[model samples]
Target: MDEFERHGIAVVEGRDAAARALRSPELTSDPGLGSPSVLLRDGDGHARVRGVLREIIATLEPFPDAVRADVETVVDALGTSFDLVRDFARPVAGLVTAAVLGVPLDDVFLDHLEATTANLDVFGGTDRQGQASAFRLSVQLSRAPAEPGSGLAALRAAHAAGRLDDDELAINPVVLAHAAYENSLNFLASAGLSLASGVARTSARDLAAEICPARYVLRFGSEGPVAISLTDGLPFGLGRHACPGSGVALAEAEIALRALADVLSGGCRVEDVRWKTHPVFRGLASARVLVSV
Candidate 1:
């Protein structure tokens, strides 16, 4: 039993059942928190907000050569002995996210975005630090200058065109930034750890299924909060609230992991491996990869 189960939230597992539940009209993404994030609402408003985000994401559909090189650069910079989470995954994920926002994000901002994972609580905001970090990010992104045609810039344009309300404009950029950064960060580090484990190299989608970061997503039903397990291979999820950026995420992972394969090709030994205890978000806390090349 995990935190959600303890809080009387039902755990819907198995690929088939989870898929059905996810697409069911009986379940809703909104937890009644009145959060304006696209991930937290339903109906026309959800569609509208998602449409704006989808357009912004489509701009990077095939991903981009520049970002791909950035990913390779981050991985190639790895030294013989380095922490996979710190040295390999962090920079790679950070670079892609910064590209997504068209704004450079510092380590402190990324750290706060990672901490916002705790704010995904179904039990009505228990983590003070998470909430604080979220507030700080919201403030920062609201004031952050966006470049022309950037994701944030697109979002601002939507607001100007009356496609988004004030609350939606204020929060969704942070939501998008966090969404883009957190899962990729977890996925990259977990996949790096997997490669360092000497497993047979596999496709990014396959590895994404196996590693499954952002393990469970919350939905609401008559009974209350329900945690839908993604271990069933629905990593990007299903139905309306599905990760709109799945295409970008998969492409991003394929490039990063392919570049990572070369880095780990000579074989490696992993040391002091540690995993995060967060039930909903699965990832490595740290793992030292000692390259033998």
Candidate 2:
């Protein structure tokens, strides 16, 4: 059995297991947004979904200009490449979470999270004590606020009001970072692949609309499980604990896709596209492309 299954982490496969996981009370009994350890418990239940989304959206805006600009810059850099896993996804995610959580981010913070998240595959075993160090570094770096009057400050306030505990509060940034970055990365990668495959493009506003119609995007690639793996089992994760930020994640991805498509529409084409050898997640670590305006 896979290590995930051996550890009782629930290795869901097949479309049915995927579907059941989405609605499984075990997954949603607690929210996955605030911390990793807490995810072991039941999630906060599904009624909290809308509130979580709203909170994330509201938190992301009104970020310090520097942070927002950093996000755009990183995303723009990622656009030149055909792959989206680490190059595009992690950086974009860091920006999104920093923007949303009012966590001030710089190249340092971005680099740290990118490294930590990327090394997750290496963390489980005794082989890498560095993984543990990186994890601690993420926790520490994620604590700082992006701006004086950002939503994270308010979240802290609310937490002090007894609304959130120390574990939850500490975990908020980590979760936020993971949520915003990873999903954004995946969405961007998928969008890029879609453009590359000619299945979709950036310039066609109408086509973008059709490709990203929430439900449709959620199940868009059932036909090619190997290429895109839209089987509904673990693509977006499962149960209520699945990605609450999916809607916004989709929008971020769509925006990135549109940008890429727009650039390509202007005569740019990706070249030397590459892929990371990751199984749980699929993405291109890097690629060289020609961007002609």
Candidate 3:
């Protein structure tokens, strides 16, 4: 998460830090000067994002076909009214982090991770009481045993190797959950809604294939610029603390998109997918959409 704070300099990434720095007389108060400066201040978000991408590509390269097939089957079974944010999107995103960290995909584990981290749009931790409660529960859940060479095990091993300290070990999973869930859910919900409403399904499907799995997400300029141009923006986020798990999130979402496209190729079409109202993040608070495919 600190990695993101360092690297993902998008409006959201270093928001707190920038605000703090601005208070210093050394910095300019003009929002314009502060904007790009915060973005340019190198951070670890990019490196982490790269590492996560590498992990995802490795994990999925061996099982892409099977993963795609499974996603297709599951979506098909759910029978439309498919809430991408809930039914498919966040679960798969969470799974990617779990897979990398060597965590098992148990119901309890997933619930804990989701309850705590799912609502996080920013890769950094949340301040809400519910977020705090979830964080505590998730930490306990992550300490549970799992298969060898799994994501959690790997994280443990990394810590043992001194790659990560105890603090990093304890915090990384929460970081992972936050990284994986935020925009992945938003992308799925946003793209799915666009597809369902006949607003750009094909374009979204194509773009998902091309960009859903990001190489690196960059945040440029100030918040005003970002807010002004939502189109063509990378959902992986921007700046130094943008997202370390962008790759994992992208792979999972792309795979899901592919599955949905193939399954609903002829039979089903999406309709009426709603988005959340909060300005802090993007995702479907709830959506009612039919999946006839």
Candidate 4:
């Protein structure tokens, strides 16, 4: 069953319909939460905040060599038996996220980032713990010092330059961090699982299209809230709010997946595979990959 039916949110399915809906000016990402996060708002504020985010994303557009080194090091250290999520995907995503924001993010931080996925979900607005996770991360980033020339620092500079107001400053750092972390975390783990399953080989781009981690995004239309499906070749979305950081994400994937391929070059067996139940983000909960000795 379509989960949106239970929530009373209409769904725009099919490629052409979804694409048209995404391009429709009548629909909006805003849910009247009056939230300051770029993902939840529309109009001028959305553009302003999104512009700042685009600039930050541009810094890592081509991605840095360090990203390749980071994923390589993590994959190289994998033991004969490892949980793909815990040992491989998590660290690769976490490390790249840290680089994206120029902050030190440990397991605890990554855990909270994962939890905050609910906060962004139109279906998950009622999740108290998810909201709490988002709040906690917002506070954490606000107080933590940022590395110069990093995303966090870039956001602060934008705030100082009057590009972002108080509310925008207060929440956007968390928004940016979550946006950077969650998709990568989900996509990498899901993609890693696909490769480990010995499925026919495909490029990271094709894998992403097939496994579109972000299944849907919310938009309020005259008919009320609706979920626009992304399964239709629009993995990164489209129109006004299309993902501004896709290039960086793909670069991250190419490096990480290449390293993963090398790690799995030899024969391997998989067992105890689990999958995340989250409606929006598609990923494995856990999977044990035992490389043949």
Best by TM-score: 1
The residue-by-residue lDDT of candidate 4 on 6-75, one tens digit each, is: 8888888888999999999999888888888899889998999999999988988677888778788999
lDDT of 1 by residue, 144-252 (tens): 9989989989999999999999999988888888888889988999998888898888999998999899888888999888888999799989998888898898899
Provide the TM-score for each candidate, comma-separated: 0.97, 0.66, 0.63, 0.96
> By descending lDDT, how would the candidates be arranged?
1, 4, 3, 2
Q: Write the per-residue lDDT of candidate 3 for residues 33-139, one digit (tens) a residue.
A: 22111122233532433353345336644445655565566666656456666776666655555555555455555555545533232333454654664567556
Error of 4 at 191 (Å): 1.1
Q: How far is candidate 3 from the true structure (C-alpha RMSD, Å)?
A: 8.5
Instruction: Give the TM-score comparing model 2 with the true structure, all chains together.
Output: 0.66
Off by over 4 Å in 4: 118-124
> What tens-digit string does per-residue lDDT give for candidate 2 at 98-150?
66666555666555554544323421445254355356654674455435556
Lowest summed lDDT window (length 10), candidate 1:
117-126
Stretches of candidate 1 exceeding 4 Å from the true structure? none
Can you tell me which runs of candidate 2 are displaced by over 4 Å?
1-11, 26-38, 43-54, 58-91, 117-149, 202-230
List lDDT for all candidates, in order. 0.87, 0.49, 0.49, 0.85
Q: Clashing residue pairs, candidate 4?
A: none
